[model samples]
Target: MSSRHSRRSHGHSSGRNSRRTTQNTAQLIESLNTHRVNTLTELCRIERVAATASDEDQLAFQGPMTSAWTYYVTSNNLLSELRGLTRNYPFSSDALDDAKWRVSNDPESNRSWNYAWLVLIKMRDDQMVEAYAASEAAKPEMWGGRVPEAEEARQLAECFAWEWNEALEQMLRHWDTPPTTTGY
Candidate 1:
């Protein structure tokens, strides 16, 4: 048996180091959700299993990983931007794959969403939340005690209180649009 499998059975983290998210986390979560909402038109159907699985889980990790990796790399314009003070590096393909594996294997995944649109948005949001939680739980050596309130530091918190109220308002507006298809 691998050490990783053994480790998985036991819960990790002592929970002593976690820190609450600041306002900047709220802002980035907003930007991500806004970007998701603005671009949420369906691509052509996958045609293999619409009912069995979302085209989202069907979409391979590489495509989105490439986009996300590039996004941070370009936006921050530095290799050091790959990680926050207390988190995993964005450039690690293995870590990214492990994350995808964990989520895909989650038994409760996709239980609440019917459409691909909603499923994709919800999954990405869930990942962001998890990353924040994990980052917050670790007291990194480099921090020397407390992470600063800088933009980079704020991105990794124990938990982000997402402004779902505003997001719900945006989502409600999206739903308010007239239906495009006539069939039930």
Candidate 2:
């Protein structure tokens, strides 16, 4: 329906125009698919051995959407921090919900750990190899003490990737035009 970069400035420049029209939408979609597949594989591998303590390893897994939500939350927080927020933004539903809970239970803890909680618990724990690698030992437990299985993680990653890409595409499409202004 809408195309992103329609025209260039000044002159025609045949070579430049050719490359501009060579839309990479298909390539981008393929890349997204590959990312999802790779993410799912990594998730499956890590979930096998997340818990350090005995008997803590057998917790039931979460469904896909929740898992993917965790991934999005973690990724978003990382991106936000890289961009430098004066105060951390709530990047995930889980983090936001935790913050809400803290507002009632312990509001003071809401700032830092909420973001970290989603990252370690939801994102890192999904990968089994990443769990026992010593580095993750320092990671906090947001689930109280639960680990999602590979299947759950995969479904979550795939679903989240699909939904997110779709939403992003939609947003990009809407960016083509500015909103009309009406005044009295």
What lDDT score belongs to each candidate, Candidate 1 first? 0.34, 0.33
Q: TM-scores for all candidates? A: 0.23, 0.21
List model 1 lDDT by residue over 1-184, tens digit each.
6788657544343232122222323333344333331232221111112222334432442233224323432343222322332144233333333444554576654442223223223334555445533454343643667655555455543233132223323332433322112210
Best-fitting candidate, scored by lDDT: 1
lDDT of 2 by residue, 29-81 (tens): 23333446223323333232222212322222222323432454445533353
* Lowest lDDT block of 10, candidate 1: 42-51
Clash pairs for candidate 2: 45-128, 46-127, 46-128, 46-129, 47-128, 64-156
lDDT of the structure predicted as candidate 2: 0.33
The count of backbone overlaps in candidate 1 is 0
**Which candidate number would show the highest TM-score if scored against the true structure?**
1
User: Which regions in candidate 2 have their CA more than 4 angstroms from the true location?
Assistant: 1-145, 177-184
Worst 10 residues of 2 by lDDT: 175-184
Q: Please give me the total number of clashing residue pairs in predicted model 2.
A: 6
